[model samples]
Target: MSRVDLKVVLLGNAMVGKTSLMERYVHDSFNCNRPYQNTIGTVFAAKRVQVNDVTLIMGIWDTAGSEKYDAMTRTYYRGAKAAIVCYDITKSSTFQRAKHWVRELRSIEENCKVYLCATKKDLCDEGFVSDDPDIQNVVERYASGTQTKLFVTSSKTGENVVELFDEIIQDFISNPENLQKVEEAIVLSKKTGERYCCAI
Candidate 1:
């Protein structure tokens, strides 16, 4: 089997549906009333996304969005092959939080592929969204990236979730040199202490 190891850290402010997005994508279901769970440390989920002949294993680390847990988050980003900085379309602050994560990832990941995701499209689609400029401004900031095709997603209605990972895998494969860096990072991290990062 052709396997692609893809580790993604989902980052954003609390209550922004980061976990809900993962549940929707990985399980194809969403619960609007699940009790709050503390992911201040980390939460992990794994699923296989098949793209052509490659079996891509996405080790998703659903991370805490609180600034208090920022250091913990950095330690977890050690060997991430990719990151999906998710934000809530209805909440502009979450979008800013996503931007912060992008900046942090840029420093830690030498060659990690990344995507910016806007979760909870249901809010906007259902007309319960806020009149927030963050949504429009964030989209504009990430337009080129999302266009070159490293951009936004809505896991609620299954938008771009599959395509996002597909593009990451294809992009990584297209750049063999970068893929080597990814593999080396993973191996070295494992040899040390990083078995895997949390993706709650």
Candidate 2:
């Protein structure tokens, strides 16, 4: 089978469950009772999945969400094929931070697919119900305006975690135009002597 490689980044504020999401998707396992510790810089994981006749190796980066590591995190955004900007459904502030993550990803990687991920769905009894209409409005508006996919996922419950990555991979496989754009971007970056985070 033909082999392809892609980079995916997860971004959000601290305690937004970015690490848990990555762990769940990459390993199909998560520890619900684990103590929370801030990601100092970034963590990397790799997973391989077959889409059609192609074997895709995804290099997933779980970036640090704290302000101290913001500079370090920005370096990993370049040349990513997809970005998951995650937020805690129970915390409106994380949702707002997710928006900022989206903007940052766009500014650095224009052609990268951005996914608005509402994390920790298990905590919400009704699965992402928000009392604030403005929060919903902002999330919907931003996603629509940016033409990004939005997903509600729970790392603890394994809800939609695999589905999210599968959807992204399938979308790329189905859309030749998008795949071409990503390839062109990679070539352009190489020609300009710019380094892609997951270049290999």
Candidate 3:
């Protein structure tokens, strides 16, 4: 099978469920009883996905959302091929913070494909999120302005999680330039004897 390696990063504010989303996607399971704990640094997980005849090993990086790790989190943005900027549907504030992450990613990784994800869809369905009309307005406006794809996901139900990563992999395959960049980065890292974070 043809093989390719891709780097994807998850970014958002604390409690936006970035970690849970990663777990659900990578492990196909979610822990409802798991206690809340701050992700201190970054967690890396890889899954091999078969898209047609190509095998894509996605190295996903889940970064800490605490403000204390803002600098450290930004460091991981260096060579990401795609970034899933997530927010909680129930909290409009999380969506606001998500915008900031998107801006940072655009500035740092101009070529990176960004997906604006609203998390906790189940909460929204259960009327947990307040009637924040402004939130929808803002989300629509911001996503349009940035020309980013938007996805509503529920980690608890495993909704849209697989589709999200599969779309990313398909995008990588469809874009020759993206594939070339990853290959170039690998070659350069080999020469320097360093680990290559795939080129953004």
Candidate 4:
């Protein structure tokens, strides 16, 4: 039996609802005022999705979004297949910090799939809907420059969140050749009596 593994991590400034979005997917429930728990290093949720004939086992890691834990959190980025950089639409400070996280992820993973998400849209005014020329312009510039897909989502309303994961899994399936390469490398490394980290 062949199993495909994926690790998705969320990175951003604190209080952007990263954990809330995660819980909504993993548990199908939401809490409006749950106490914020700092993920000391990395806390994870796992789910398996059936994509056609393949089963993708996704492991999502939620990182602590605190300045004091920055050094500790970077270690969790290692071996990630994809990442979602989240920011609060109402808070420009958190929005601005997303670029730094995106840059850091790109530096380590040559082709890491990066998704730029604007969280908490329910709080923002429709007058400021991101599709507006001014807003879309900003998102476009940032996404293009950073090599990421910019998307506006409301985790509270259960919007676009599922599509985000669907697209990511589709991208993985689109590359059938990579899976064979991964398996081949795994077999070769095992015979050599050692492990190679970069092959995946």
Residue-wise C-alpha lDDT for candidate 2, range 1-200, written one tens digit per residue: 22236788999999999999988887778996789999888998877666655445678889999878888888998888899999887788888788888887778788788999988878775556665546656777778898989988899999999899988888666768756755665566557875333222
Candidate 1 yields a Cα-based lDDT of 0.69
In candidate 1 the C-alpha lDDT for residue 92 amounts to: 78
Best by TM-score: 3
**Candidate 1 lDDT by residue in tens digits, 1-200:** 22226777777788777787777767877676668775677887887655554444677789888889988888877787777777777777777677777777777786666677777666677778565845666577575664423445566677766676667677756776755655675566657765433322
The candidate with the higher lDDT, 2 or 3, is 3
**Segments in model 2 whose C-alpha atoms lie over 4 Å from true places:** 1-4, 126-134, 175-200
lDDT of each residue in 1-200, candidate 3, tens digit only: 22237889999988889999999988888999999888889988777766665445688899999889999998887888899999888788888789898988888899789999888998878767545756867897889988998888999999998888878888877898766665675576567776433222
TM-score of each: 0.76, 0.81, 0.86, 0.80
Q: Supply the global lDDT for candidate 2.
A: 0.80
TM-score of 3: 0.86
Q: Following a full C-alpha superposition, what root-mean-square deviation does model 1 have from the true structure?
A: 5.4
Ranking by lDDT: 3, 2, 4, 1
Model 2 lDDT at residue 42: 92
The local lDDT score (0 to 100) that residue 152 gets in candidate 1 is 52
**Model number with the top lDDT:** 3
lDDT of each candidate versus the true structure:
0.69, 0.80, 0.83, 0.74
Per residue, candidate 4 scores C-alpha lDDT tens digits across 44-100 of 787777766554567788999988888888888787778989987766677678888
